[model samples]
Target: MSLFRREDLHSLAAPYALDALEPPERVRFEKHLKGCDRCAAEVRALSEDAVRLAWSAATPAPAALRDRVMAAVRTTPQDPAPQDTARAPARARATQLPPHVWGTQPPPRQRERRRIPLFVPFATATAAAALVVASLFAVQANRTQDELTAERDRSREIAHVLAAPDARASSGRDGRGRTIGVIASATEGSAVVTLGGYGDPSGGRVHQLWLMRPGAQPRSLGLFESDTPLVATGLGTSATSLAVTVEPAGGSPQPTTQPIVQLALKSVGFGE
Candidate 1:
């Protein structure tokens, strides 16, 4: 006989073997297996293996844990008194008080009383919600200030790499003897890198720029789209140099090829 015509049953076999199937699926699978001898045998073997694995992983629970759990379970539950049943008689008595007080007054013209407005619980809840939302926004504003400080530090590092004199110049002829592009204008926080007249690399390879700071490793700025100008981001304060290299379709942790462009940045007024 065919092993369980239901595709869902076959999908449930592994979970059933592991005892992870929910109640409905487990019952249905068991019914299906009664007529399918091959599936039944396979499931039996898998179940045994699962039991063995669980037994190997089993460890004794702490002795006090079970006692504490049972103590909590044995506690009696308390029910609250119903509000309407408790308040109905009190409301009736309060209404009677007004009538008795009116009888004791000297005259309607001489006795004057003002009714106080009742408080609305919903209005109080709405005001509380508004206060909570305002507090959350205030916290977010403070977090943004901290993020801006970190971004400024990154910008300073990128500026340092662009100022190096020994950095590889982006000028020269390509393999085809045509003029290759040159990267120019290196500075702290921002730099003007060049993409030249040569054709872009093939096979999904793209150029990537990096900011290498003194005592710190290089960090990726972004991918350099072929035929587009080079720009960098996240330059930290006191960054000493810049490098550009060929990377995979996405880019890698380190430069995979020689840097096509390089620039050195100066440290002057970096902290400011």
Candidate 2:
């Protein structure tokens, strides 16, 4: 004689009406419903749709026809329950709850969050390292370029001096006061001298170039053999006159013989 609640109707009547119950459960529900008027009414209401569902499923119709038939049917409205009634103002409920009560606790430790794979930091580090390396290489390449430029300039200066018209003029008096063997193309500098067309000196002694300045002592340039027309030796930059003298096998601080060759350079402004 108890009335069946909508909540309990699904369990008590749905299985029997849908034919999903076992034979024993079906028999038990049928027996209980015989004296139960509330359950019988619930079953009758549900049976109307249950019979229609079974009939439609058993008979297959054309797809277009089925769609037309289904379009004519309307769904039934479901009754709300106690829980549904309370859920009417979910936003209000949320606002009433404390911030801590929700799952809004401070984030987990950094180590735990990093468990998921990511490559942002690693990619950034790689890019930065590449940039640094590129900058370093660029600096080194510039330095090498500067050095090469300087060397090229030095070589060009040497070539220019060698090509000058006055570079080959050499004049001097021998020990006998004879204006002996004229040499041409002589280039002189503070530390070195170069002469052309001067034959080699005889014996073990080598030819040496000296510079006689106004008041300073004669400085020894380097010793040089004269077999080749070209001769290069170290001399002082303060010399006013360029002289070549025969010296001992190595060389001497002073000229041992009268200058076999001499060239007085005209007054010219030389710049460093």
Candidate 3:
């Protein structure tokens, strides 16, 4: 019933005991172990196994060494007066405390000597996670830049085609006699259009473009936004007209709502 396999859960015990598992995954496993006796037992056994290895590998000290250390410890006198501690003693300078304890004396210089070895694995994993996040943001930024570049190029191309020698344009009126423009390259079938100030679509609907030949079914081009100049290509050589209609967001195979505007292209020699 769990999302991950039971074997996968069992395999995490060693890493979990060593504090190597990442959080959230580690937290989830801990929660699961509360109910799963088998997994809990396996983690305990693995932890004890590590302790057993430490015990087995330890070397025994000589028998007389303990008595000698005790005698030396007894002869060393303890400091009783705190006010006489202004002098730096040679014995204090020579003493070396284990690294795990906080040193009572200041270091000769203030600086990082080295990183702690225990944190290396976690630090590496955190750095890797940060790098992966940065890469994803970089990719998204690049894609957005590319899209803007392409849009600028497209606007420039539309302007060039409109200014070309062989290009022509036409206009058509809606039921209210308001006009929309269609401009195209007479030879290449490239065109730009205006939506003729049609109102926005209702919810769950969109505006669609079509290429129509006289007395024939319209071919769907794609979707468009209102009142903006639409740039299109691949208009059939026989298409003498174009239309805009409302449809669902994905656009229909055929016009589903009544056309809001129609442009007669024959007069402009579009797709001829």
Query: What are the models' TM-scores?
Result: 0.30, 0.30, 0.42
The per-prediction tally of clashing pairs is 25, 8, 0
lDDT, model 1, position 49: 77
| CA lDDT of every candidate | 0.47, 0.43, 0.57
Q: Quote model 1's TM-score.
A: 0.30
Mind giving the per-residue lDDT tens digits that candidate 2 earns over 117-195?
2222234433332222111111121235455454234223333333445443334444322232212223344222343
Model 1 clashes, total count: 25
Top-lDDT structure, candidate number: 3
lDDT of 3 by residue, 1-272 (tens): 66668788878888866556777667667656655656665675566566676698799888799999999988975432111112112112111211111122232332221212212333343333222211111112123545555534544555555655767767775543245666687676777775533545789688899888777888887676533456778776688778888899889999987887777787877544
For residues 1-272, could you state the per-residue lDDT of candidate 1 as single tens digits? 53446776767666777768666666667656554545555665566677789799889999899999889878944322122222222322222122212232212221111100111122443323222211111112123545545423432332333334422234443342223232223333444344443335678898787877777767886776543344454455566666677889889887778877655544232222
Instruction: Name the runs in model 1 displaced over 4 angstroms.
Output: 1-188, 267-272
What stretches of model 2 exceed 4 Å from their correct place? 1-160, 163-198, 227-238, 267-272
TM-score of 2: 0.30
Q: What is the number of residue pairs that collide in model 2? A: 8
Residue 233 CA displacement from its true place in model 2, Å: 8.4
lDDT of 1: 0.47
Deviating ranges (above 4 Å) for candidate 3: 1-147, 175-178, 214-216
